[model samples]
Target: MTPPPEDLASEDAKIPAPASPDALRDAILSVAAGDADSFAGLYDATSARVHGLVLRVLRDPAQAEEVTQEVYLEVFRRAAGFDPARGSALAWILTLAHRRAVDRVRSSQSQSDRDVAYESRANTQEPDPTGEAALATLEAQRVRTALEQLSERQAEAIRLAYLDGLTQTQVADRLGIPLGTAKTRLRDGLLALRRIVSAPRQRKEE
Candidate 1:
């Protein structure tokens, strides 16, 4: 992973806007043809946008910067496959950044969930089978009711991600939408479900 730059604040103001579409297309073609120097120019022209999109998705400067580097490496390796008729170079680059950032977020969430589950199991006493079954049934019903409160798209994203064990990318692919849209649905759905689940607890405490 690339380390976050020490002078990012100072450099951000100096970074110019992205190159023209024609210029970027030419640069990508040059890079595809083995011109390493063109890769530098392409990075300069689009790195800010790439990093910004990644940061927006990741909300972590260090991780965004690292993933931004990974996106560029992917771009360089796959530049030959870029078709100008399909889309502009910048769009393609940003799409790659978004996918990579989403992947990183999912990977972090999976690890965190695993750690929490492990700790929970370790601290738990021997199960009371009857009591456990009753609690589990109630919890499942509550969750199902909460899920029904979400919009169809939001609920679908949550189901694919949590129940089907699919990544955000997979959810996007399954729904025939972009990865960013899938992420938004999942995030919004989770927030809504959180509110629904906590309402009873708040009422009980009141």
Candidate 2:
């Protein structure tokens, strides 16, 4: 056959510096049994690749640092479970790194999805309408005055949910209020908006 592709030869050449599975196994055993230098060497050998994997999944430098630290801690805690006969030590570390990266990505995605839903929910809730041009202008002023009349916590909840496009849950979380309290604040704020808009006309008629 013609010579294999040069790139394939090059790829094979780039394989990690050969690490003897037997030596790795001995190191794991040595570290688990409390040979401090073996454990330190373990950190020296694996940190770069583990950190790369963390940064890929987290896409945040700070989070990558935290996650990498967690990976090393986990390795130290669970090293006794390593079964060297089944595979290479590097393979084990790589597997753990892969799992941790996937977990971090999934968590980030979940939070992102929650934030989007909250935004959509906040955008959909509203108030009332008016009759005259004066009524409309007064309605705008009343809406502001109504909002201003609320308790600080109540006003914040309404602003977050109505003006700023946050979910009730998000408002509650941001304001440190209970979920039931957030709902009650929103309801009360809307009620105040109605009364304020109607009050000027009620007074003029009288």
Candidate 3:
């Protein structure tokens, strides 16, 4: 596996010995008190073990690296609530890493399942030409209405680029405007169109 970044690595030369449990606990306490140096030391000393556990659960180097960073961020945010009576500092940190890794795995699986289900439905559904034509007409009407909401210059830019199938450069040439101005019009027009089109759906959802 690829090693972590240099800045994240422990500065072993600075300390003659490995981090003791007492030292880790002290670091956590200091971290809770907003000591930046203590937080850095804690991360350096414990990151390897934390990352290893997360990587084992995730089984993907890139994802493990991301989750390890997230785990440390959570540790920093919630450090003030660490309870020595309930558990050791290392155990607490490890638990956070494990939980975050598992959550990532579950979230990935859920998204995959949703994609599979959508594909299955799309494949099995029968085509209805009449209904499809009606739907397409309604969609086109909606889009035209949305286009009407934009300024004439913005609307002209969108139609030239999208409906006329012109590149931004071509659109600029056709409109006799600078390429940057053409891009700005297209961007603003699309944003306004999206808001206009989605307003009805937003109201229904609410």
lDDT score at residue 32, model 2, on the 0-100 scale: 58
On the 0 to 100 scale, the lDDT of residue 164 in model 3 is 56
Report lDDT (CA) for all predictions.
Answer: 0.72, 0.63, 0.72
| Model 2, CA-based lDDT | 0.63
Per-residue accuracy of model 3 over 1-206 as CA lDDT, tens digit each: 32233322242223333488789889988876666667767877887787777786789986787677667656765787899887778777877887888889988998799788879788766546678579968866886777888999999987776555566677889989997788577656655665566678679999
Q: Please write out the lDDT profile of model 1 over residues 1-206, one tens digit for every residue.
A: 42233323233444555577799999989877666567767877887878877886788876776677567656765787899898777767777776788889988998799788879788656545678579968966886798998899888987887666566677889999997777567655655665677678679999
Please give the range of 10 consecutive residues that has the lowest summed lDDT in model 3. 3-12
| Model 2 per-residue lDDT tens digits across residues 1-206 | 11122222232333464445577678777765555556656766666666665675677776676566556545765676888786667667766766676677787897799689878888665424436556847745655677887778767776776556566567778989797677567655544544555567679999
Which of the predicted structures, 2 or 3, would earn the higher TM-score when compared with the native?
3
Q: Which stretches of candidate 3 lie over 4 Å from their true place?
A: 1-17, 123-206
Q: Sort the candidates on lDDT, descending order.
A: 1, 3, 2
TM-score of each: 0.51, 0.48, 0.51
Of the candidates shown, which would achieve the greatest TM-score relative to the real structure? 3
